[model samples]
Target: MSLTHLDARGAAHMVDVADKPESRREASASGYIRMRPATLALLAEEGLPKGDVLATARIAGIQAAKRTHELIPLCHALALSKVSVDFELDSVTSCVRVTANCRLNGRTGVEMEALTAVSVACLTLYDMCKAVDKDMQIGDIHLDSKRGGVSGDYNRADTYTEQPTPIVAASAEAGRVPLALEGERTPSVRVKCLAELRERFGVSELSVPFHELASANVAGLKLALKNQYERFIDIDDQRLLCAVNQSMANDDTPLTHDDEVAFFPPVTGG
Candidate 1:
C-alpha cells in the first residue's frame, strides 16, 4: 500500500484532504499508568503532593488532543468538536486506566487526537505521582475505536490477558510459601536493571539463585543485591520500579525460581 504521509518521490509530506467530503469523525483511545498501592491510596485520598492529579491529567489530555498536530509531524489540524478524558483506578493492579474520546466533523479521522490525549494523560498521572512513586509505568496506549471516513469504522478487540497470579500454599513455619506447579521447575530468578540503573550497575542482566535470597520475595532480592554490591547502597526502593514476569509488582510480591525480575527507574515520555 502507498504511504498516505509520503509523496511519490518518497519525501515525507502531509496528506491533503481538501477534496474529500467532511464527515462526523470520532475516535477513542485508552492506556494505563501503574503505580505503587501506597501512591494510589494517596491519590484516592487527594493527599498527594500534587493537588487533584486526576483533574490535572484530564485537562492535560484535553489540551493534548487539541494540539496533537503540533507534537506529531505531517498531521493535519482539525477543529475538534468534543474531547473527553476519563480515569479508573484499579487497586487489584495498582494502576490507573485512562480513556480519551475525540470527535470532529472533518474529512480526516480523529484517531491521532484521541491517542495523543490518552498518552499525555498517562504521562500526567505519572508526573503527579512521581514524587512518591518513582517506579510507576505508563503503557498499553492504543486506539480503541474509530468511526467515519472512507476507511469505514474500526473497533479493537478485547484481547488483553491478565498475568496469572502466583500460587501459594500455607506452611506452618513459613506462613505462606509459593509452590511450584506440577511439572514446573524454578531453579533461579533472572534479574534485569534497565536504563540508568543498568548503567550504574555496569550490567544489564544477572541471575540470583532462588535459595540464595534472604527471603523468596522482591524485598529479599533487593536486600540481597544491596548486601552484595556497594552500588546498590545509594538506591532507594521507593525510587525503583519493578516487574515480575512482565507484570508490575511491589516489594512484597511473591517470587519463585525461574521468574523474570526487572528493576528500573520511572519512565518518561509524551
Candidate 2:
C-alpha cells in the first residue's frame, strides 16, 4: 500500500482528513513505571522532593495529549473533548501502572493522543522520582482500545505475562512505545544501550519484545527497540550505530543469549 504521508514524488505531505466524517472517537492506552521498592515507598509517604508525583504526572499527561500534534509530525491536531489519566500502584512489583483515555469528536482516532498521554505521564513520573531512583523504567506503552472509526473497535485482552514475555505483533499494538529499562521489567532476553545511545534516547536502557533473538544480529535488535520500544514511527534503522560488549560491533555482528549490545546514531561535529 502507498504511504499516506508521501506524495507522488516521495515528498512528505499530510493526508487530508477533512473529507472523513466526524465521529465521537475515544482511545485508551497504558504503561508502567518500575522502580525500587524504596522509591515506591518514598512516593507513598510523600517524601519525594516533588510535592505530588502522581498529580504532576496526571497534569503532564493531559497537557501532552493536547499537544500531541506538536511532538509528532504529520499528526493532525484535533480539539480533544476529554483526556483522563490515572495511576494504580502495585507494590508487589514496585510498578506504577498508568492508564490514559482521550476522547474527541473528530475525523481521526485519538490513539496518538492516548499513547502520548501515557508516555509523558510515565516520563514525568521517572523525572520526579529519578532523584532517588535513577534506574526507573518506563515500559509497555500500548493502546488498550479505541472506538469510533472506519476500522471499528480494538481491545488488547492479553497484556503483561506470568512469563513477562514481550507482546508480539497484533494490530492493537500499533504505535506502542516499549521503552523499558532494567529492574525486572521482562523475563525474555533484553537489549540495552551503552553511553552514547543511552544519552540520546534519554534512558540508560530499553528492551525489545522478542521471545528469541535467533540468528538476528545487532541491527535487528536496534530495529526492535527503536520501532517497538521507542515508538518512533519514522525511525530509519540505518542511521543507528551499534556495539557489543565494550567494543564496537557492526550490524553484521552475531548475537547470543545474555549479550549486552549498545546502540547510538552517528555523530557529526564541525
Candidate 3:
C-alpha cells in the first residue's frame, strides 16, 4: 500500500494528532483539463444535456471535500469550515481552471480536503464531457500551500514554467556525504527544494547549513533546481549556506510561488 494511505504498519490507522494543537488551517488545490476546440464550442453553446457545467462541477467539488476521508482510508474525517470553488475559462486553450480552497480549525490541516475537491471537480468535468471529448487530459494536481500548523508556512519559489508542479525530494543515505567540498563547488549548487525532496525521499525533514552547499553528487539536484529557477541569483558561500539552512519546507501549496503565478493547466466541463 502507498505510504500515503496509512501508517507504516498499514493495520491500525489514522496518524495520531493528539499531541498537536488546534489551529486555523487552510489548503488550496488546483487541477487542469484540456479538450479539443470543437468540444469547447459545444460546451459554450450549452449543447451538452448536463445543464450548467461549471455549476455542477462546483457542487461536485464541494461534495468531494466532505468525502475525502472515505476515499483516502487513513485521512481524518474533518469537519470542513469552508469550501469554495472557482472556475476560469481560457479561450486560447478551450479549457477551464478549477481551484478548491478548504479551511478548518483542528489538530490536523485540510490539505487533503482541498486536493480532493479539485480532483473531484476535474473528474466531474471529465465525466460530463468525455462522451464528446475523450482526449481531455487532467493534469497537474498539487497542494498550492498550507498554513496554521506546527509545520509552519511554505511557499514554492519556482515560476510556473519551471516544469510540472514538483512533488518532493530528499537526500539518500548514501547521498548525505560530508560537506567537505573545498572551493570547487559552485556558489550555489541547485538542490531539490524540500517539498519535491519529501515525496521523492519520504523524509519528513532536512537539515542544511547556511554555507555553500556541498553534496557528494548534486547532478540530479542541479537538474531539478534548474527546472524551476527563472533567472539566477549570484550568492556567496555564506548566503548559499543561509538559504539551504534556513530555507522553509515545502508544506504549503506548490502553486503559491514568488515570481510567476502558478496555475494548474486548464480544466473543462462538458
Best by TM-score: 2
List, residue by residue over 11-81, the lDDT tens digit for candidate 1: 34677899999999999999999999999999999999989999999999999999999998767888999
Off by over 4 Å in 3: 1-12, 157-270
When superposed on Cα atoms, how far off is each prediction in RMSD?
14.4, 13.3, 12.7
lDDT, candidates in the order shown: 0.79, 0.73, 0.58
lDDT of candidate 3 over 1-270, digit per residue (tens): 022222232223467788888899998888788888887777777787677887898999999999998997668998899999887767797787888999998999898899899999999988898888889988888778788897786444443444422222233344344222333322222232222223433343222221322222232232233333311122111222112222222212122111121111111221
Q: What's model 2's lDDT at 116?
A: 98
Better of 1 and 2 by TM-score: 2
Candidate 1 Cα outliers beyond 4 Å, as residue runs:
158-270
Which candidate should be chosen as best, given lDDT against the real structure?
A: 1
Rank the candidate models, highest lDDT first: 1, 2, 3
Ranking by TM-score: 2, 1, 3
Clashes of 1: 0
Instruction: Give candidate 2 regions above 4 Å deviation.
Output: 158-214, 217-270
TM-score of 1: 0.59
Please report, as a residue range, the 10-residue window in candidate 2 with the lowest summed lDDT: 165-174
Model 1: lDDT of residue 242:
79
Q: Candidate 1: lDDT over CA atoms? A: 0.79
